[model samples]
Target: MNPPSLSFRARARLSRSAGALLLATAGLASLAGCANYAGIRSDKQPLDVARIDTAQSLPTQGGQWPTMNWAADFGDTQLSSLIAEALANNPSIAEARARLDRAAAYAAGADARRYPRVDGHYSVKRELYSGNALYPEPYGGSWYTENNASLSASYELDLWGKNSAGLAQAISEQRASAAEEQESRLALATSVAQQYNALAREYALFDVAQAEARERQALGQISAARFSAGLDTQVETRVSDTQIATSNTLVSQLQGSITVMRYQLGALLGKGPDRGLAIARPQMQPLPVSALPDNVPANLLSRRPDIVAARWRIDAATQGVTIGKADFYPDINLSAAAGFDAFGFGHFLQFGSRQIQVGPAIDLPIFDAGALRARLKDRYATFDTAVATYNDTLVRALTEVATQIAQIRSIEQQQHDAQAAYDAAAKAYQLAVIRYQGGLSTQLQVLDADRALLQQRQTLVTLASQRRDQQIGLIKALGGGFDSAPPPRRDALDAMTSPT
Candidate 1:
């Protein structure tokens, strides 16, 4: 037997052979399960958001652009109050705010993974074991209880940037959500202001309708006097009656409109119809007239909340693509565990019962029939959608601003023409009334002048309302009411502590 023993070098060679055999098996398994990339394509084109150019000057628009809190520029406390209420209680805004909270939580969860993770584990068990003397049908059995407790820790190597890419994507989404919340606030505030403007407009029209009714009554009284004295024709009397009826109808219709608008304002304030009924006519304020700079700043696009949110979404999608590609590489994780275990309770804490384990694990994604490639394709598609969305948002935002500038210009010219017409007609009506009272002009002539005056005054009212509407429209289109959000921690923390 001693003569047949092999040398140490021969044993070393045999061990090397066994290792080679294991490696060969691994290679064969990889080949057998490998994925094909024949139809899969990698789209690596550089991404960009479209830049829509716009001319910056309009004849009728003047005064520098309205500053933030533009509703205050109108100097209507009621309007400011409505906007504040909407921002606080609008359901849509609350939903968006909730979304921001969810995104912030996701961001924190993702970031937490950058460091190591530790966990505690414990277990208790009772087992029966056979002690074999002859190992017959019913061998002697003994019962024993075991207790174990352990602490385990693990961390990822992040060798190929997979974890970092995931973290980046999550953070980008959080920022995007914050921007979306800003957009929501801006939209709600603008909506409240527009509704308030509508209420003001209705009140102005109601006043004009009442004035027309008064003029109609005066004319009707003169007609009745002439008819009773047999100095007026029946046709003239009928015409006066018809005109009076028409004026009353207009006045009633205007009152109805005013009622409806007040209700609408109440709803925008997150209140009920009764709240609107308590409101009075808006104190007239100077029309909002603002001019933008000729050269739109490069950062102007970035300032728009929607555009900013869209860009962040694109960034998040890009990181998603990175994460998908990273899946093709091997992932390495290091783990460790230390604990105590014993068959009996008394010795559970003894040195001989101690246990510890430490090691590294490697996962190779060498198989799966095109699953990884398919996932990568899906990610690329998401990225494409994000880019398209961003482009569309940018173009729309720029268009809104440009169209508003032109609209304000045209409305200003109309206001000028209407004021001139009102002045001329008013003078004519005053002179005609004086002449008739002095018995120097016919009743029919005085009535004609008064009707003309009413028409011109109504035209002025309509123009003023139109200017107010356009002014608010332009301000909203320019995103003039909101600023950047407060720091994320303050907002996110508040959301976390908010009641369910």
Candidate 2:
């Protein structure tokens, strides 16, 4: 085969085309600033997921994760109903729903640019003519009418993919909005659970306080009797009375705390604070210790709704950078109008009343005092911000899971050891009473043992309350266990064929 070379004219034309190509390439390459921003999809932990504790990841799914009623762990029907009601009616959820709609509408509007737009306009006008104007000599200052009817249409050529970029940004934002709504719902549900757990703890503490007060009074009475019988000194009675006063104060304080917790719980239920007083106290149902999923770090990044929303925002920002760069080129649009127009009424609908006009409009970025460049810079910075925020969110989530897991583990041990201490104190109180009755121990000694037993019992109650709260905390850290709704079907074909 023979080798062929370009002639003189072809070579010159080719050089111009190559120059234009280089200019366009340079413009787009400026937008490659997108490469500087970190991606949200990479599972590699930021600062090692902030050194997350591996012991308490969320539970692994054997099947699809359940429609997790996390509050059910407490075995309380009232609590369950409260959670369900809050999800159905909370104001925050309503606001999130409205935001989702707004974002979807914005996305739909952006999609409109993918097609042509047509509009119909009609107008009738009557105006008085000046005597010196045309036909004024024949009919002085007479009124004349004009009529116009037209169909005007316009479509963008999308030479730079600007319209598509806008649509992509909008869709990414809409996905982010949906994720935000999920997060809000999860937060509301977890808030109700936390308050409900708090109410339970307060009630348990109240019971312990009441029992301790009762035991303290009994000891005070024993101390009084011993002092009168010359079996104990005035110092013993003073110590007993002081102990009783302290116990009484604690009982009052616990009563106040319980009332406050009830008020807060009622408010969370969207009821009056007075309603809090009317609600029944939760029973001492045992909360089971839960196991974290083996893939704690990765599971949190993939499953947490907040994390998902953050990732979506990063995508939106990336598309925004593209949109900003696209503005550096010319915008091309095609418009057409066809219509009937006339000065005379009868002839307005007849023959040459019809007219048509069509053309293309082009807008080139000639000069802007560096405005476009500044805007592009801002878009890149915004993308950087989104990436930083996403990494920070992952870090905090890991820290929270670790902190909650550590607390739960520590509280469980405290619970076991406190129960044993209470048991030992109870036996000691019994032996002291027996010895005092046989005159082997003083009445003061018996009173002291009784006081010690009450303290240990209170300590055990405190541990129980802590365990319950931490268990709820652990569940919340795991994203409230809401099943992930499937990602919206992309329908690439349908999306292409029907932008609207």
Candidate 3:
């Protein structure tokens, strides 16, 4: 024990260890700094400069806009009027507009989250007191009332850009919804135009049927006269009567279809079925004489509203991941409260009653049994889904463009061939009628030729209408004319048009 006592100073020197601990702590802090910096940069990198360019090759470029005025594009005033009515009254449009309003309002609210929150409140309370203890002599209880008023304030400091991310996500969603509304508009316009074209074709067919019926009725009268004169058989008169009956039935069916079309048009304009909405038949405008562009798919991303909406979805998901990850870290917030409190109303504003406090509050997540981790996992999965959906939408959009292009071209050729057939059939029918009158061909053969002519004409009309419909489809698949709109303003329309 005497020998160990001599080593006290040496033992104290050997036990000193704070220098090593300081060095280790510094190294760990450096590593954390590097990790945090890397993460912030990573979050920012993915969102830089994400935009699509337009190409002259996209069919949407053929028109200045997605033909939001599709009916007017066809040069029909009646159709334009109907479209206007539909836009004003359609339930879907109204719903979309309301949703847009709500989104704008929410975006405004979200933006306000970045600012301090202030609230004023007043309260009144009554207290009952009993004095029966050793320090007091009173044995009765008395009630008292007090009133206090205060203004409190709270604000979360966006230390890690969490509030910014949330706001961005909300704004992006608003933009996507607006794009969806545009998509719906384009779809509705296409439907109206297509249905109008169909109605017109039906009318053309009706005209042909009525003409044929009139001719057949005249022929039936002649057959009846001939049969009475012993020149034609009852079987021939019956055949004429049967043809007339068939043509009359067809006319009736076509008339019913027209009525149905009128009802449909009225419904599109948000009117009751019996509103007697009149849809004047839209005659076919001449086929587009402009040259068609060939072989480009890149512009579909920029021109289509659905494509824009999908991209916005991806942006929103990306922002969501950021916000979720931020939750894993500490939340820095600033809160303040100021108020007046006193036992009497006269003393409420006194110096002793005045109170004010302000401070920063930090919330650190120490443990939640993996709750934050699971939420982060879910958000990442959601981001992945968004990415996949965006890619799929792009692929589908390209495919639609290609398919529509092919359809348009094929319909064009079909229209040409049908026109030739109609011309030849018309000439042949005329010649057959002349030949039959001159006793070179039978009346039955002339009737057959006339029917053939009508069929050929109807086929031509249908092919032409199909081409029109396909053109509209191609425009839609290519993303319409959103690009043609001026760049969005930063304030008023920002919530609607911005990628949040």
Candidate 4:
């Protein structure tokens, strides 16, 4: 009455079919239990550079971008050398480089995750077998030496692109770090230049102060002669002596400022203050005509190191969002372990003592109590923040360039008037001195004209310094000669709305 038994081949085929059905059911269950990530996404949109208007602020004529050796253009070899030294030795640059190296290390680790991992382990121990345990006969209640050796391997199935996304995110971060390093270099260079320019201005002003003191001394001699001749009172001679003292005080103040400026330069060079003393006075060339490049905001994204760094951070955040979404799916890994084990060392290497294991491990986020959702939401928020930061940086960059341009134009107009005033004051001082020598004017009149001339000279010096400073500002605003390829036109919206 019993049914006929199936052949070996038929039994094997049925076993295969049953195994397939089981796997299919498990897969469906895993998919059904996946954490929900619906309705969570970044909302911010990056600003489109093409849409922003900059017609009035930027000049229409085409101009060249700043060269890599732009500091050399200032005609100060010392400035160029100082910038080179700062770039090499500055702590800020070193910190940025360290960040870049760390990011690269992280990227390498992520890349390693995409491939299979293998590990080997070996152990030796002395153990006691219990009589009530699985050990048989004399083996029970005996102490023996046990040996174990194993080689295990595992590979994650990135069906959800988790590992790949992580690698991409790390790469973006590395790129951002690199751009940040460049930014630090640019900042240091410009700072050194501005400080050097200030030192030069102080030196020029010091020369004028010394000249004024000499003129005051001469006037004092003349006033003394007039008093002796009974043509002027002691009051004029005392006034001339006070004027000379004031001029000398100004010279002393300038000397102190020059010393402090040198100290600052030495610090920028990553050396002692004495290094700055070795720095000769900067012989800055005439300011080049200020103009804008043919490309404005559109190309500025790539030209400016800060903006480029911001764009890379956006890419990194996008990848982070992708990684968060992937966390909602099942993490499947295939693992295999083969090893030899024996109660005693004598038989540990025997074929009969060998064992092997192979299986797929699944980690499904079935009941994480909304942890996965929270993480994904955080990622989306980070993405939104990055997009907003990038937009803000772009807007600020444009405004900076425009503000520098406007200031430069204003300075140009002032320089012309300043030159004329200086000429007129020089002529008036000459006439006053001539009249005083001819006894047609009082010594006070000559002193007044000299004061006016000194004022005009100082004004001209300040205007010239300001014009140079504005030129440097404009150069920095235009990206300080840094250049790179444009980032892809993707933004937060593209990342948030993409299919999970």
Off by over 4 Å in 3: 1-65, 133-140, 221-231, 290-296, 484-500
Compose the digit string of candidate 1's lDDT tens values, residues 1-500. Answer: 01123359856775675576457545644553354334444333222322333443323233454466778778777777777787887888889989999999998988888889998888999866666653443334767789998888999878667789889989889988988988888877877777777777777777888887887788777767777777667876787788888888988998898899888878877788998898767875866455764343233455678877877777787777677766766566778777888987998877777776665666767768778878878876777676677777777776777677677778788879878888988898888867755557777787788778887887777777677777777776665644443221112222111221
The CA lDDT of each predicted structure is 0.71, 0.72, 0.67, 0.85
Candidate 2 per-residue C-alpha lDDT over 115-156 given as tens digits, one digit per residue, 9 for 90 to 100: 999988889998787888666454657877889888889998
- Against the hidden true structure, what lDDT does model 1 obtain? 0.71
Taking all chains together, each candidate's TM-score versus the true structure is 0.82, 0.80, 0.80, 0.93
Off by over 4 Å in 2: 1-67, 133-140, 217-249, 483-500
Which 10-residue span in candidate 3 carries the lowest summed lDDT?
A: 41-50
**TM-score of model number 1:** 0.82
For model 4, residues 287-376, the per-residue Cα lDDT tens digits are: 677888986877798999999999998888888989998887777787877788898878988877776666666677777888988998
Candidate 1: pairs in clash: none
CA displacement after TM-score superposition, residue 177 of candidate 1 (Å): 0.9
Find the candidate with the highest TM-score and give its number.
4
Best by lDDT: 4
